[model samples]
Target: MTSTRSVAACVLSTGMAALLWATGLASPASAVQAVIVVGTPSATCANPQHPTIQDGVDAADAGDTIRVCPGTYNEAVNVTKSLVFRGAQAGVDARSGRTNPARESVVQPPGASTGFTVASGVSNVTIDGFTIQDSEADGINTLSAGSGFTISNNIVTGNRIGINFRSPGTTSTDSRIRRNRIVDNNNSLPAGGSGVFLGGGQGTDNLSITQNRFGGHVNADVNTQGVLGGGDPAEALTIASNTSVDSATFLVLINANNPRVQSNRISKGPAEPSGSAMLVDANTDGAQILGNQITGGQGTGIRVAALFGPDPSTNMRVTRNTIRSRTDGVLVEALDSGTFSSNIVENSTANGIQVDPAVAPVTPLLFSSNISRFNAVWDARDQTSGGGTAGTANTWRGNVCPKDSPDGICR
Candidate 1:
């Protein structure tokens, strides 16, 4: 009889290329790249040749497809070439009760190793639809000098970090991490970890993290840090439309430039010192925080500070957000040249919106058209040295509040 691999290749050469192209497994430019299957043969993946995912990856050329069947893989898969690794149920939500052992591809890394590591200089790699867990380190880690990576639709939990992008010298750009369930990935606490970490020595550009669910993290759900000593900033990073709960911090942007965080639903941040719903700190600039729903956090709903250095958080636009917290709804420290406008802040144990005087001379901030009420402290309190005055420094205009620090601040 003829061999299975040869028969599969012959079948792929005929009309299977069109099917692969239609399913986004292969592009038109690489239409003839073979599809290597791992695990037992099934209706979707016929002629299964490799017993392990690493074997399939080792046999596949660049731009080939590795289709993993429903099974548990207990090994570290390292990818050096640009290829598409598709699990059995790619793009299906694992939280929807649709994931059964008969159709789930799970990767549990043995010992302290990571589930998957996209090596340096490997670009255009896609890893989709797999439950990767129980790793002491990151579940999925991408090294320096890579771009165009798409990691989507998987359950990543019980690891030190869910997904990590570490670019040391060169910059990684144009990566999309969407539609995944990342939970409880803070197995290493106190030492530091996050659900998704974009930090090594350098920062990424045009990185998009959206439409994900995150919870139970020791550190922030999504955390990004720029170069250590400040060389180049993480530019054009977008964190939008995600739901995060019960994390130490929901989102943190440090040394980032022009980051847009919008339309996220965050709730129940921990009562720790780092448990803010959002923190825009350090040398971050040009941040757009808009249209988020924050509820019931013991910590501040939103905090803009410059705690690390003398470079104040500047040019931030915080607008149209609904915030209800046990602490201050919005707190500003060492912030300069920002607009806090059109937000509804209520039911806070402390001030609804406060500008701390500890960072004195918080100048050139515009507070306009906001509704703040039902707070224990003053609804709007600007305690900077020259604040709470009409023409002093910080401008509070057209605000609807019950009470304010200065008599003339509420309208």
Candidate 2:
């Protein structure tokens, strides 16, 4: 149980100790401590040592390192205070001059649920390098918003919800969910099993879901929808450089505000009855959908519209994206304001760009500087209401179509 295995970080030095000590790692008052967990160690893994991971966490101080050796910790670790639960190969080797990868230790719950939960009121906690699986609920549930969490380099699979960021009533939480392999969280029952779910009612500030693999045997890879509660909308959510494939519903379903959905590879696979590669719903205040490569098979490749919602989809900039779809390449409807420009839309059977404002008097949109081709239907269409009277003042400027037959409000 005490055999050395490859892991995440390294021991802090003199300068580093001072910084982390103020941050509560290693100081004269808050000494840097290590609690080791072996399968069958002589001394019980308590504050300084314990046999179980949870025991070490419960006994340790606010700033301690529970260095678990390579063994299947058959229990859920509930982290209350700010601590680091790393594996044997968690840190770097200063003597060897090589960075060792984090321990691929297994953390399957023995009796309770969830692998590692950063409990409420706990900030600056890190859950790195563990194989967390088979939970009745979420794998790692950051129970509420307004807390800080850094979850990196872990394999989270076979749970009802992978990483559930439940934020209620517009609280601001800072989180970084990067470099994790979140997969195969299958829940046939309704309202479960999303790879990364950002629940409604609250706002997540300084959120970064970047460079993660979110696909394979999941319902929705990433689903983000927050309500317009008393607090302000989520500011600066960055979902970039992730690869999502074979998702049953919505590779990236974003109904949040001011999100930067850039440089993601999304494929709307599995062919569910109702789904899309991407969806930006009516509640979007301002969004930048740029530089993405979306391959569609069943539903719309990129849909920016609302259905019977009061909120206006305004100030969106959808540019530099390559959308290929069986349905509309870029569907915009029921909006008050937006701009779609410099995009390459290709369709095999549907329209490349379909602008249909189902609202009264037609919420005006600008379709400009785009290229549409190879669509069976119209290359660029505007099926707004009332022939021309209702769909007035909507501008279609400098667009290039192969057939040269532009429809509705194209001047």
Single out the weakest 10-residue window by summed lDDT for candidate 2.
92-101
- Stretches off by above 4 angstroms in model 2 are 1-30, 33-35, 38-48, 88-103, 110-112, 166-173, 226-232, 250-255, 268-274, 307-309, 359-363, 385-393, 403-411
The TM-score that candidate 2 achieves is: 0.80
RMSD of each: 5.3, 7.0
Tens-place lDDT per residue, model 1, 20-81, is 88888984543457678888666755667888899988888898888898888999999989
Residue 3's lDDT within candidate 1 is: 13
Q: What is the lDDT of candidate 1?
A: 0.81
lDDT of 2 by residue, 1-411 (tens): 332223435666888887887888654643445444544442322223467777777777776766776556778888888887775434321112222233346777753377887777677677776667777777887764435677777777788878877533334456788877787776434556688877645656677888887776445777765344424566668889887777755444344678888998877543644456777775677788889887766677777666424575677888898987657687765666777888998864678877664633234566778888888887877656443322444667788876433343333
Give the C-alpha miss distance for residue 58 in model 1, angstroms: 0.8
Per candidate, the number of residue pairs that clash is 0, 20
Q: Per-candidate TM vs. native? A: 0.88, 0.80
